[model samples]
Target: MHELAIADSIVQIADRHANGRRVTKVQLKVGHLRQVVPSALAFSFELVAQGTSVEGAELEMEEVPVTGSCRGCGVESRLKEFPLQCRACGSDDLRVLEGEELFVESLEMEEV
Candidate 1:
């Protein structure tokens, strides 16, 4: 699964930022469009984190709903369904405001 690669990257980032500190939590912002299966990602994270500071750390994911601003109608809305269209007007010219992001926001480290 691609989650393995994603988790590997996460561990690498966390380990790098942690600077040898023990990580207790890893906060993430995951967009709906990413289609990440939470369970799989968690499992993958655990597997990838073996022997690293991130091991046993909690993986907290915040699901970012798909939101966009319509260029035609100048309306901002949450796009629920794909063939992503503007809610105000039937326009495909949407500038995505949020969602479609996979970021490691922060990490909580153990006491030094």
Candidate 2:
């Protein structure tokens, strides 16, 4: 799965920020639309972080729900599925306001 690559990238980021220090934690913001498996990502992180500054670091994932705004009724609502129709107006004309995100939010580190 892509989680391995994603985990590698996270390790790289944490390692860079750690600057030879030990990483204690890494927090990430992941959106529902991204379809990332949190458990898989955590397992991959452990594997990828071996021998790196981020080794043994706890990975904290915050899941973001999908949100959309309707162009027809100017209503915003949370979306549960794709081909998203606005929940309030049931309009097919919509713009996504959130979801489809994957990023590192913060890092906790210890001095060497």
lDDT of each: 0.92, 0.91
TM-score of model 1 vs. true structure? 0.91
Using lDDT, give the best candidate's number. 1
Q: Which pairs clash (backbone N, Cα, C closer than 3 Å) in model 2?
A: none
After TM-score superposition, the amount by which residue 76's alpha carbon in candidate 2 deviates from its true location, in angstroms, is 0.6
lDDT of 1 by residue, 1-112 (tens): 8889989999999999999999999999998888899999999999999999899999999989999999998999897678788888889999998889999999999999
Q: In angstroms, how far off is 109's CA in candidate 1?
A: 0.8
lDDT, residue 13, model 1: 98
The ten-residue window of minimal lDDT in model 1 covers 79-88
Model 1 Cα shift for residue 13 (angstroms):
0.6
